[model samples]
Target: MIVTIDGPAGAGKSSAARSLANRLGFRFLDTGAMYRAVVFAALEQGVELTDADALEQVAAQLRIELGDQSVLVNDQDVTRAIRTQAITSATRYAADHPGIRALLVDQQRAAAAGHECVTEGRDQGSVVFPDAECKVFLTASERTRGERRYHDLIARGEQVTLEEVLEKQRERDERDTTRAVGALIQSSDAVVLNTDGMSPDEVVDRLYEIVQQRRVAK
Candidate 1:
């Protein structure tokens, strides 16, 4: 079984997907981190964000490992480094490029080729894994997601204000929904869950039940 949770950034997709995978004893694939790793590497190499050809070249050569708990790029641990607000804002240069999105989609499918997996990203259901057994389009208000992101960043010892985070979150939402390739949209067959005010455990439990129901139906 492959469960796909698709939503915008700052939504609790990562937290809920990780916890749901643990509960279901399934492998977790963070597709967003794949794009983030590419972005992080691109910025590290000083590749211009507007250079799509340069970005594709970097993605094709770098080694991205998606462990159960961490992300490694070129054999270097970049799990935390890639999640910073800087990379988050600059992620679209890679994600929006058709070539880079195609390359990463290949990697994402290969990673889940023979496993029972729970994958989360902006386009998992609509593009990467359209045939997934259980597809979810998780929704959360922009403000709610911003608060979550702001608190998480503060907890990580990163100094950022709620206003800044929310502003960035809005920009991300606009870009994600309007990107040229792999844009974020709810699949026709996906179950839409508005996650505002939902606890982490509650979210996973709901997803778990949804998956179980799908398993029975399958």
Candidate 2:
């Protein structure tokens, strides 16, 4: 079975998906990290963010490997590097380009083939895996999401204020929902799960139960 978990930043999609995959013995694919890797590579090569053509080229050339908990770009480990604020913001530019998203979508599909996978990203169910057996759209209020992100950055020892984190996440939510290519929206058939007061384990348990129900229905 292929499970898709789609949501905006700090909605617990990544953590839930990873844990869900582990619980079910399925492969976990973090599609966001692929775009982040592209951004990281482009910035490393000094490619201008606004240059869509150059960014698309860089995206096409990237060799990204998604492990259970690590990300590798071009054989170099970037698990922690890509999560920095710099790359996180740069990923918006890379992921917003239509050409870059198209290229990455193809890679994402290829990676899921021949495996029971749990995939998470903004457009996983809407665009990348529309036919997934179980599709979940995780969500939370902006304030809740902002607090989650702020604490996450703090835990990573990044010196950032709550106000800054909130502002950036608000901007990201606007861009993600309004982007022309692969815009983030809840798929019509997806089950929307609010994570405002839910723990990661609770979210995954709910998703796993849904998957079980889906299997029986099938």
Q: How far out, in Å, is residue 214 in model 2?
A: 0.8
Clashing pairs in 2: none
Where does candidate 1 clash, by residue pair? Answer: none
Candidate 2, after superposition: displacement of residue 33 in Å?
Answer: 0.3
In order, candidate lDDTs are 0.91, 0.90
State how far residue 84 of model 2 sits from its true place (Å): 1.0
Clashes of each: 0, 0
Superpose all Cα atoms of candidate 1 onto the true structure and report the RMSD in Å to 1 decimal. 0.9
Report RMSD for candidate 2.
0.9
Position 90, candidate 1: lDDT: 87
Error of 2 at 101 (Å): 0.6
Candidate 2, residues 1-218, lDDT tens digits: the string is: 89999998989888889999999999999999999999899989999999999989998888999999999999999999999877787689978988888899999999999999999999999999999999999999988988988898888889999899888998898899999998998999999899778877787889999989888988
For model 1 the TM-score comes to 0.97
lDDT per residue for candidate 1 within 1-218, as digits (tens), equals 89999998888999899999999989999999999999999889999889888989999999999888999998999989988888888888888989999999999999999999999999999899999999999889989999999999998888999999999999989999998889999999999888898998899889988999899999
